[model samples]
Target: MTPDLHWTVTVDPLTLAIGFAHVQVEHTLGHHFSLYLGPSVKCFDGILEGANGPYVGVGVEAGVRGFFWGTAPAGGWVMVRGVLASLSTNVPNTATNLGGYTSALVGFTGIVGPGLVLSGGLGVSYFDYGVLEYGVHGLAPAAHTNVGWAF
Candidate 1:
């Protein structure tokens, strides 16, 4: 069977203009489950209210999928996958009052592929805003979606 490769772009709800790229890899793990790993780059829209500045973050996600439709060659599958990610960003020295922060996010992704797949899902993120802080703390629920090619 041929392998599946795809690129996913997700736009954040809070910062609609800001988006991230995920390089996705899919592998079959038997009859019911498939494994996927995505290394991503997330860009923020310059800290909230000018408290800090925009920063780039690096992270990775690992998840498994349970397929519910069609098979390998026919080209359509509906699968649910769970992902966990750790992201880090640097705070500018000019913003000494602000410190670097890391975030942990967990989310469920549903993918349907038939040449091009429509992807959408919801997630909750918990940020440990080290030095620079604003708004709420701990966990926040967010949603995302994207349209991209699937192969």
Candidate 2:
């Protein structure tokens, strides 16, 4: 059989406008488990409250997927990922500042169709508020619907 190659694109509606995409190559282990890993990229562009200004950044992400549902290509799965990005903001009356955020998220994965995966879960995030000094750290709800294409 040919190797399995799939690409998935995901987005979060709660975080203004944050999205991610990745390409995964699936490797079947025995007859009931599958493992896939790939490089992912995430980006954001929107408004920022306070003196910090607009929020914008590009983060490189690494993700892993594990499927455990017999030989069926569509079923339940899980994912864990980490993201680190270089971020900056343009605050009026202030110099261009630099900051970044690191996040770790885990979610339950489900396949809805021929090539669709729906993942949703909760995660904790740490944000460094650049010049603001005071950062943010808390638990947040995360959800994403990804469409995959296998070939």
Candidate 3:
């Protein structure tokens, strides 16, 4: 077994309207085919105009990543990752509520320079806000890109 560590800074272009970003620490387990876990912080500044705009929120994100091409901790690989998060927000004059989202993605990870890596993927997202009765009714296109430093 080989263990690898990385710090990642992520952005989802599609979520730009809502101002979403993620910061995560990843730990990889196993050798040939790695299984990884990421603990993350998700931050958002607003929502779609129709839903509500200019409200800030923060969430905790958890993710699992599987690399099929080869070992992790080093090298290039093809990966699939699943992410889940829960967030709470308050809008001025509006009710405070909590929401959650999940994503399933297919991507690639490549080592660029010493201790540096880049990863990106396309996926679908499902989001729900129980209190507001508002959500992404079905699967919506999602994309993610991240730059990381591994040690």
Q: lDDT for each of the candidates?
A: 0.43, 0.44, 0.54
Residue 142, candidate 1: alpha-carbon lDDT: 42
lDDT (10s digit) by residue, model 2, range 44-107: 3233332133434444545555555323234444555545544444555645344434444444
Q: Which ten residues in a row have the lowest lDDT in candidate 2?
A: 44-53
- Tell me how far candidate 2 lies from the true structure as C-alpha RMSD in angstroms: 5.6
- The lDDT leader among the candidates is 3
Flag the better candidate by TM-score, 1 or 3.
3
- Give the candidates in order of TM-score, highest first: 3, 2, 1
Q: Which stretches of candidate 3 lie over 4 Å from their true place?
A: 1-18, 32-52, 73-93, 129-137
How many residue pairs clash per model? 3, 0, 0
Better of 1 and 3 by lDDT: 3
Candidate 1 lDDT tens digits, 73-121: 2233344333333433474462423222233233334445445444444
lDDT of 1: 0.43
Return whichever of 1 and 2 wins on lDDT: 2
Name the 10 consecutive residues with the lowest summed lDDT in model 3.
1-10
